[model samples]
Target: MTTPSPSPRLAGHLLVECLIAQGVKDVFGVPGESYLAVLDGFHVHADAIRFVVNRQEGGAAYMAEAVGKLTGKPGVCFVTRGPGATNASIGVHTAFQDSTPMVLFVGDVASDTRDREAFQEVDFSAFFGPSTKGMAKRVERIDDAARIPEAVARAFMTAQSGRPGPVVVVLPEDMLTQAVPDALKALPALNPPQAWSDPGSLRSLRQMLLQARQPLVVAGGSGWTPQATSALHRFAENWQLPVANAFRFQDLFDNRHPQYAGDMGLGTDPGLRRRVSEADLLLVIGARMGEATTAGYTLLDVPVPKQTLVHIHVDAAELGRVYQPALSIQASMANAAKSLEGLTAPPDVPWAEWTASAHADYLASLNGAAAAKVCEGTLDMAAIIRTLSETLPPDAVISNGAGNFATWLHRFFQYRSLSQGLKIQLAPTNGAMGYGVPAGIAAALTTGRPVVTLTGDGDFLMNGQELATAVQHGVKTHVVVLLNNSSYGTIRMHQERAYPTHVLASDLRNPDFCALAKAYGYEAEKIEETSGFAPALARAMARRGGTLIELTFDVQALTTRQTLSGIRDAKGH
Candidate 1:
């Protein structure tokens, strides 16, 4: 008697189960016509994968980035073909530049519909080629479904490997409907090679650092794991090296540490720039050295006497892509840091003198005109940041949406604890706005940790509708909305600087965000005075679920703790 064949549906179900085994719990996407089959599969396995439906494909991608940043895992975003895929590109690019691990799954038209001008047909691979680490299209045969697990493994491997980036997997409509045998469930997850730094490269890098009278280390991206961060701090401490975090990575180094220099961004401390330029050797690890991170890529042009640049990155393409490096080593940032630690003996240098000077400068800068600018108003950005820093639990995770508000957070906020338990997560580098709420939601849901997401009016409105998602999932997040009543405060700052009399497209009138949050079933409060801020935050945090605290401040009060050189440049200064 012939044996009965196993159901293909079960095979498809198992394929999804394998994904769960890989530790992917959160997915972002807006359901589309072409993705119904996968949606059905997802619904069948809803217990394993928690899908967060976003209002837009771009929003979904940003949400995925948020998850990646918070969990240090590959966040997944699903979308349909053509327009859906196109809309998701912004977030993918953000993930790529920021070195965030993410997977973008786009549903494709059926294989038969190729070149038929079918509904939602597009060259998805070509579209995602520039922004992703790897791309693949779906195959229909049951045996082809075997590749799904391997593909996902490879995608995640590439995403977290060299320089973390986004990966795209295009699924054809038929592939989701196709079934595989139950026996095919034993496929193993693909394990990518862990490429270590060569001894010679590590020796050379060490020699360069040792020989230089003034050496500096710059950290960026999400490549620095907890172990790596500890190793880095130890290395810096032992060798008496000064370290500066790129952009929002200040938490990577203890702000109270003597060797810690302020971050590099629009509001970068002038003293930090001076120290960076004075360094004889510049060691950049895991950082892309992107335009924004490098002050429009002009920081490299600063004259450094006897400058020797050593860049360690996972992605070979990023080694010398921005500022030309004297030595570029392609290896995992963690592995490279480990190798460097083994190779370099601690130097006998008075690092305290340099750090003390730098710290003094940073403190003076904070107390100077910048501080005055931040504290002029009753409800200033600096005060809010200080209050939050003082009030929040030491281990509370803070997520900020990209905007003028983030600039303030980056400059003023300091993480005191070096323990992994008190760390923070922000957008890698792409500085994508509208990710704060979703990321806070993911963090709260994944860890049951208290989360606060700070966003500006423009950014909140971008993906504000996701409030419903938070309420649906029972994730409690305290959202602090900075009501600036402007579309782009940074741009307006520039426009005002350039043409003060010319009222450009900078003004914006927005709806009452607190009322809107209440309408969406969140406990919402509007904060118009300083006295109400703490009570509102306390009430919001007391809630078992999501809450929105809308804080209205003078539009002119929106200023970054960092200097706004972008506006200066825009004004032809």
Candidate 2:
């Protein structure tokens, strides 16, 4: 009746074709038998897309998340079901809270054995259910070989859609080997849908700005390109507003700019917090104003802020999800920034003095305005951060995992503008530990730029094995590990306040990190004082391979502002 169907092709090979069609250059994951066909497909199309083998599922997922932050597309990661999927959930949660676009492919058990709960079988949808409290934005399973194109396309689109986040696609082991019609093809690459601010909303935003005597712009969140960041710079410059980046999104604005008002997060400047609370108008662009950025919801009143809020975000659902704003504009960050840049500013603004004062506060905070309260040992963290700020290239990619150790980096290291080249900061807003090493490796691999990761002794070990991935890939990344021989420094800081001198489960018996790095084929050194750090860093920067520098400090150096006992005394403990 009809011409014979073209020779069938393995669904795994077709899946790789779909990814290649979507312009994916690399896939990060661990090899597993459940997805052996997909692994073979990767080999078949190795020239089109490189498969990066990671030491663990979490590291693989983190690397994918970092790639998503850097590229504004869905960074893809593959893992087998059950433990692999559960292990990869950390990165998914990080991506969700950080608003980074990512796609995690979980190879599930064969369709026949799925409900039986066979070995390594898992129901991914329930595990990664999407909700305000859940980890992923969407979860789906591809049960048919012919529908691979549709599933893959939708997954990518869902990940990059409004309020970008991670999407989970479960692939059955049997489906990967199924033969599909050779004629079937992948859908074209999809671009993130851009929602533009309407003229009326833009007018309202302008009117609000005009009426305000003191206004502050909080900029941060994912989906920012160089062009968008440049537009944001122009918008800030045009209005002469003092801009404070939200939480971990420090590189969104050039910290060197006079209008830079510092970062808003843990260890926030007291002056900046005062300004946020006192500002007549809060023009929040891209930032969700989450608990961390709002100092656990203490800075800004919940449900309804005291300040006249003009909240512009990409997703409509996020507008009134927490604080009801005076004006809410649902538009992509790129479009919103572009529209704001187009809006003309008056010749003289009343908040000029206010803006100047905010910037001055930021500068003073940078100079250790509160350093007198804290006592340090052999090494000074602030000084080390300052050295990094001065030595690294303007476009160097800096990343860190969660820890009190990051406070120094956040406070002292000034980030260059993203317009310089790429997203320079890769810290997770979700406060995920063990994120820095894999993120740094991903940045170095994707951007081919100088990469530096800052981590604490505990944070580094979370995904420190990823160092092997970096060494195997021959990517250059300098890792600075703060050796205090403790895990949960942040928790310990709180413990000292809540229960003084009763530390338990926080102290760590750490290994010789220097020796571990050497074993991983990396140049390693241990620096006990501030002086040795600069020389070691210089040598690391000059080297051809990866490097790890360990800096030991006293436990009293808990945070950038206060010593460990200082917290205890404040609690009268």
Candidate 3:
């Protein structure tokens, strides 16, 4: 018996079918005339996959990036050529630096337009080059309609393999519209190949651990599953090592663990910094120890670290790219963690005292006498973060963008753990200013869980229009906007430190954030004092539709560590 041939279909529909076959449930993007056929394809296969319409390309890209970070799969996004691609580049850069897997599809001018620079045309490959310094890991254009499945499969693989990052695929408009007769089906969903730790390397690491009097474990980077995190927990507990999460990835280890050292990132605890610098052995796992995590590379010596660094990373290229390690293991997080946990430890290691003291420092950084002084304002940001940390569910997801305001969230909120089976924190290690709102919306829509987006007035306005997208999708995300009437709070803080007492372009003539949120069909209120926050938070959480809480604070509440006056006074102006 002869098998029946597949009927001819538009290449766009074939592309959508390929995506569905690859297990994509949701895609985020803004509509464009260039991809109308692809949009119609989404309508035809609406039951198989849902296309989430976003307010702008940037928000759409950020939402996709969030999905990548949350799900461990390649998050998908679509946008038009030229301006749309440029606008979405920020999220691509974020994904690259954050090491999250993401795929961005750019609908381009018709095939006939070629290289004549047609309307809204862009050389995507040139724009998003694949290199050590580029935005994407891979960039390709599909000129033939029949190769959609191949291009898409390759894109997904390239995004997720080794060190995860963003990939871009360019689809010409005319090629998408062309009908093709083919029986092509998507390749089976790809799983990244796991590289296990070498037995000799593990033995070497154990020897290093045995020789050290003081040791620290820095754990973070992408390609981690709940299983990996659990294995990491077991390994840390077995060795009695203090584990410090890298940069914005604070949830990789439970903050409540007895041996949990404070996070290593911006606004890191001073005691923890001292502890890291003083440690004799550094068992660095997964983390690349970028500028933020390494405190602008001042924490460790460049090229060759002063400490005995045993670095393990999935990608061999990253193992010795920044700092030369005494021993390097090229292994996936899961495999390395599993292997490490199997090593038998001595009844009592030498670092028990060191680990306990590290945990003590973490506790002191939280609220003990060693913690920084409280912000001077009616609406105390630190206290508010403490309330959020206490009131929210253990699984509640928190997201924030770049600002001095984010320092409060990072310093005060204690992240539970990814091993708890949820990714609780979504912030950009790249320090992008407009990531929180869209990321929170995506988290709520995808996970069906409570999400709180903390944003400064300037950060909120960058992608605040995405609030409408959340309302349209019936997502329950609470947004907290910290209003200080300054558009560039972080820049202003730096300015005060450098050129004391001179305020330049950082000040903002702002609008009523509550009214703006109300315009987006949300229940909104303004809270001026600390006394009004709890009740307002309860009301927001109880509402059916989403709500926005605008908290007002003075400029004196500059950061967790210092006030505006304090910064200028230090400069002695």
Candidate 4:
């Protein structure tokens, strides 16, 4: 019996089919002229893969990152070469910093135009060098079609292994249209061996942890599965150690757990920093110990010696790259955590005293003015998070943009379930506005759950066009915009504090977001008074599809929450 040959179309379809087999349900991209062939391929399997058309490639890629963070799967984004791929660099870098898994498929210029400086023809491998784990260019031979699964498998493996990140696969326009043999149809399953710590290293780490009167466990980056988190939880509970999340990775630990010490990186709880610095041993896992995680890399300020650092990360490059460590183990976070769990016998330490201090500090931090006073004349950001926590199902995913408003949500909003926690999908370092709406759309589409995006007036305007996409796709996402009628609320606050006499390029005039949403064919409403917020939110969430609620609040209502510096540097301060 001879095996049947697969047509080019069939091969393309099978490539996507394997993606579906791997649990990929949502794909974010903006179709361009170059990717029409792949787009055509996608059209055949539209039911299996939900395609979301984003207004910008960067936004689409960021949306993929959001989906990946929320779902714990490799988020996929498709793009055309040249400008389309270039625009996605921000998102790629974001996934790198956040350790989120993502697969980026870029449509390349034809092989004929490879080096002719053809339109939209740039070396994608060179372009994505620093941002992605792996980059595969278009292969011409029919035999290379089988390599598609290998490329994809490696991409996913790189994405989920070590320091999780984005991986790019470039398909030349011609290659995507090539025919292949049927024998290549069966996708190879990827099962990389788990990287375990050496028995001697594990023993040394266990002894260090056990002997320390004050030991702290710092969690960061990605590669934290349910099993890894569970092991950490069990270890923390067994030894009564205070567990602190590395900056943005707070979602990995249960906030309600008595041993949880809250976030510990930049703008972290100051009290938590004091506690970490005072610890005799710092057991760092998965985290890169980046400058942000180490508060500008001032590891000594925390009063811990270089010899006290026991750093464990999947990437050897990351181990001791920032903070000198007495011991560094290059292994998988899950495997390392499991090994540590077995090596360490329970220690007799004053767990309650450490926990009591942390709990007291957390309570004090919450009682600050930032947590008090619900919105005066508009929807209070804090109240909205509290209400959402109370109203939404435990497993609902929430995606947020980077802005002053997001800071409030981060500090006040508590996740009952890991699946529903806040995800910083886009690279927050760039602090780009207008990602919340599209990201919310992507999250809802990917997770099949209610998606809530918290944005400010300035941010909503940046990506406001996405409301139409949401409505067109029948994506039921709730958009809550804090209408401060100002650009850069944090900057404005800083100006007021530093140079009270002058305010420049900070004040803003925004259009009526509610009216704008209505123009985009969405159910829209405006809430100016805090009193009507609950009823308005209920109405919005009850709607079957998209709803935009603009909450107008005074600019003075801006307050710092979950931030390191209470004030920024302006002319005076």
Candidate 5:
């Protein structure tokens, strides 16, 4: 009998094997000397996976977070110790707040260098530990090369389980090069089991719905499968309920559907806000009523709501964390929506007019935003957004960072299709300013589709260096920059709102954005008139590499509805 060849494996190669077994095809990271072994492992498994070389650790983390949001699986990222880990913390915090599943692996100093404040060393647990407000769900370090499989599997589990968030894993430089038996290969990645609601809770939810005259359904958070989204549609259609998506998750429900009630987030529809407050019953599904969604908790009374609250969440902890619900169903979105779809709505329900009126208010809000013509300014934001809405494909991915510039697109752009089986939105619910560029790059690389990123001058500069990354990767995305020459638009708007025109730190000085983009290998131009946008967008759509369109927006044009001069002029009105 021929003897089986002795299995030879390095810890880094073993880790890659485990990741492949778990179905991870892409990983974003910056190259580091500490993880040179892991880099080689990536080369060894080149046919199976790709290592996305990001310009900065922060951008890499953001890309990973976007992947997690798009796939509903834990997005994986690799970074080095100390500064690299710290730089990546922003994406970790974003995943925490956004309820995304992600795993961050940091290569650390050699095991012998422990606790001496070695070069590029950090206390992983202390830095990424869990708290009421912490970046990671769990932080762990693996000194034993043989234990990598276990750690990888556990990281996936921890990230996907209860209130899905990020997990941190630390690997010592010396240990990564250590040997692990090839026979002890990694097990497949684990998935969190779908938690189902109790039958009694479903019965109670049905009774509560029967007792309502004005019931509104609000959906948000991750963990929503296509099946769940379809079931939610069925549940809404069967009961003739008006549904709204919470915060940045506008794609959870089809916007074109008549039952849609618009998104509840920054610059929420006033009509929708009023409807939410006036409704007799609030059916919250898969969303945590956080500060932004609830308008700093003012929309819903804290411990108790003015309206009857029925909160259905994947995690049991989020149920009673905010508004105490009249009925709380603890189940995964897929299971909860499935259960809800089966419940019988009473034939004599009293909320028909209420639902119809809610949808009417939503339609009015959209019409109002579209009808208002340009009060002033050559580069009219309304027209620009209108052109973009008309030109882009129905399934086009819309990527944006935080700014007043986003207000224009958020108000006018309507997402109508799911090209990649997920929402086209790649915005950060945590309000990270530099999120758009990298997110657009990630979306383009993963989906192989046209990606559009709308950004302000300040927001663009935050992670604009990643344009070099896009150029290197030959990524094709349309980047629209609204330049209001020398001021942070959102902060300036807030400064105008609170302090009235003493814009101190909010004033920004920017480079020639067109020249900058051209230098980075993009087709770019500057637009000064409303009529220039559609042609620029058309040219971008036809371009080969990528395109950047810079529009000169007046600083006075602060928002979709109001201007800075208008805000200051009204003063105390």
Candidate 6:
């Protein structure tokens, strides 16, 4: 009898093989000693896949999250245990909230040192437990190196299925060193079938549409395929329905379409809000009707809405989780939109005038008298944003973090269409500051598309160090930093509305951003006036290694409509 010789390949190498089998091309991470085997695997398979080195774990996570948004598949990220996992939690939370698919691999301490409180030992399962408010959808640790394929494949599957969220996989350092046999091949990822709309429910929806005088469609959410978007447009055009995007999912709908009603998010258009209230039928296609979308649940309260509610979603668990719908249809967005497109629209919907009014309000709200005047200051933000709209290409990516400075961009910019087959917006629904800089770099590096990032001073500084990552990656994003020296603009607005002039720790002493950006190898410029933006923007687009155009905003230019003094004077009467 002959003894078989053992084939040698590290478990970490097997994990990388599994990722390649699953069609992952790029991964983002910060290097760690615990994951040295995986890094070695990356080195071995360098040509097949690329590992994006990030400055910090948080930025890496954010980059992965943004990649998840750009590409429907789960965004892959690798980080070491304990502190690394803690830092990466922010992106996981954002992915959970935004319904984006992402998989985070945490390299952990050795198996023998688990209970003893070894170096950087922390219970990952306990920390990233699954719950409604939890960080990840699933959290599991792989103790056996042989099961690496099974574990990673499961993570990918769980991350992408149903509601689509983050999954955490813990890898023991000692397990990575174990040699696996060459016969052990990596298994391919399994994707679950999309839930199709019930024919009866869709028919019921059509009947409801026929009966309504004023009907509105709130279109949003992740995983909107091209077929789905086209189907949505056809459905909207067929019935002459007004479609408003949910929260930050503006790119899901064609914003330039006549049927576009406007984005229903923070600072909801007053007229649009009123029209939403006045509507007879609310066909919420993919939107979760989240807090911000429903104006803190005041616009459309749970159990039942003022109008007939047709709630359609991929996840059955999410149907009655919040608002009980008049008719609940369990279906993936593409299937539902495709089914709806198949339905015959009546020759006259009777509410054509009502629909037109809603869209009119949307068009009027953008460049109209009210909107233009709202951005009142020495440096007209509305003019600057509008200039950006005119200057940038339709396919150019626009990303922003949380800020009052974004209000002007939100109000004034008119998104063209997803029909162009490109993701045009990358704003955060979870209200994470410093998301823009990292997201922009990721987008630019990954897509090679022109990227523009809009950020306030406070927001930009959060992960602004990632600008080094951008420069290192040979990607240039036209960065617009609104220099409003403030930590809590949104909080200040609420405080003023509640307690008048009782300001508390909102003001900030910022650095010379222009000089800092220049030091970081960026073509930096400081612009205070509206006219200066065009030239700066043009130069940024033309330049090679990226540019940071700083807008010198006055501290008094608080909100879009009012100054700090005006807000104090009002005392929120």
Model 4, span 26-61: residue lDDT tens: 788899876676676678889888788888888888
Which digits, one per residue and each the tens of the lDDT, describe model 1 over residues 1-573? 998986566434655666687777778898987668767767888988877787788778877877777656778898888999888888887777677778888777877787787986886656566542532222122226667766666777767665666778777777766766766653444444556777788778877866777778888767666777777787787777778888766777777677777788766877888888787788888777777777886778633224688888877877767567888888876687677666656546645577667767766654534654644554666666767777887667788777776766777677652336345755436677777776676677666778888888888887788777777767765555555545677666766676754667767888977788888888887777767887878777777888888777655554654234434545665
User: What is the RMSD of candidate 5?
Assistant: 2.0
Instruction: Give the poorly placed runs of model 6, Cα more than 4 Å off.
Output: 1-6, 368-375, 476-478
Give the TM-score (vs. native) of candidate 1.
Answer: 0.90
After superposition, the stretches of candidate 5 with alpha carbons farther than 4 Å from their true spots are 1-7, 368-375, 417-420, 477-485
lDDT at residue 272 of model 1 (Cα atoms): 84
Once fitted onto the true fold, the runs of candidate 4 whose alpha carbons sit more than 4 angstroms away are 1-11, 131-146, 299-307, 368-380, 417-432, 477-485, 493-502, 561-573
Q: Please list all clashing residue pairs in model 1, or write none if there are none.
A: 98-429, 162-314, 267-562, 267-563
- Going through the candidates in the order shown, the clash numbers are 4, 0, 0, 0, 1, 0
What are the per-residue Cα lDDT tens digits for candidate 5 across 1-573?
998976777898988888998899999999888888899999999999989998899999999998998888988999999999999999999999999999999999999989999998889898887776778999999899888989999999989987789999998999989877768888887679889989998988888888788999999888887788888888998898999888888888887788888889888889999999998999999999898899999999889999999999988878899789998888998898899899997666677787777777777766634324433744667667767777788667889988887877777677663322656888899999899988888888777778888888999898888888888877865555545546788888888888985779988778999899889888799988778788788888887667888888777777777777778888863
lDDT of 4: 0.69
What is residue 160's positional error in candidate 2, in angstroms? 0.7
C-alpha lDDT values of all predictions: 0.71, 0.89, 0.88, 0.69, 0.85, 0.85
Indicate the residue-level lDDT of 206 in model 2: 90
TM-score, every prediction: 0.90, 0.98, 0.97, 0.87, 0.96, 0.97
lDDT (tens digit, per residue) of candidate 6 on 1-573: 998886789999999999999988889999999989999999999999889999889999999999998888898899998899899988888899899999999999999888898889988877988888678999999999889988888899889888889999999999998999988889977875788988898789889998998899998888788778889999999999989989988877777787889989888888899989998899998888888899999898667787888888888888888888999998888789899999899998888888788888988777534434544556777778888888898778998988887777777788766666888888888888888888888889888888888888888889888888888778855555555545567777777878777778777788988888877777799887778889988988887768898887766666666666777777644
Model 1 alpha-carbon drift over 4 Å, by segment: 10-14, 131-146, 302-306, 343-347, 368-370, 416-423, 561-573
Q: For residues 388-443, what per-residue lDDT tens digits would candidate 3 score against the true structure? A: 88898887889999998898888888899898888989999999999999999999
For residues 37-110, could you state the per-residue lDDT of candidate 2 as single tens digits? 89999999998999999999999999999999988888999999899999999999999999999999998899
Model 3 residue pairs with clashes: none
**Model 2, which residues run further than 4 Å from truth?**
1-5, 369-375
Better of 3 and 5 by lDDT: 3
Model 1 scores what on Cα lDDT? 0.71
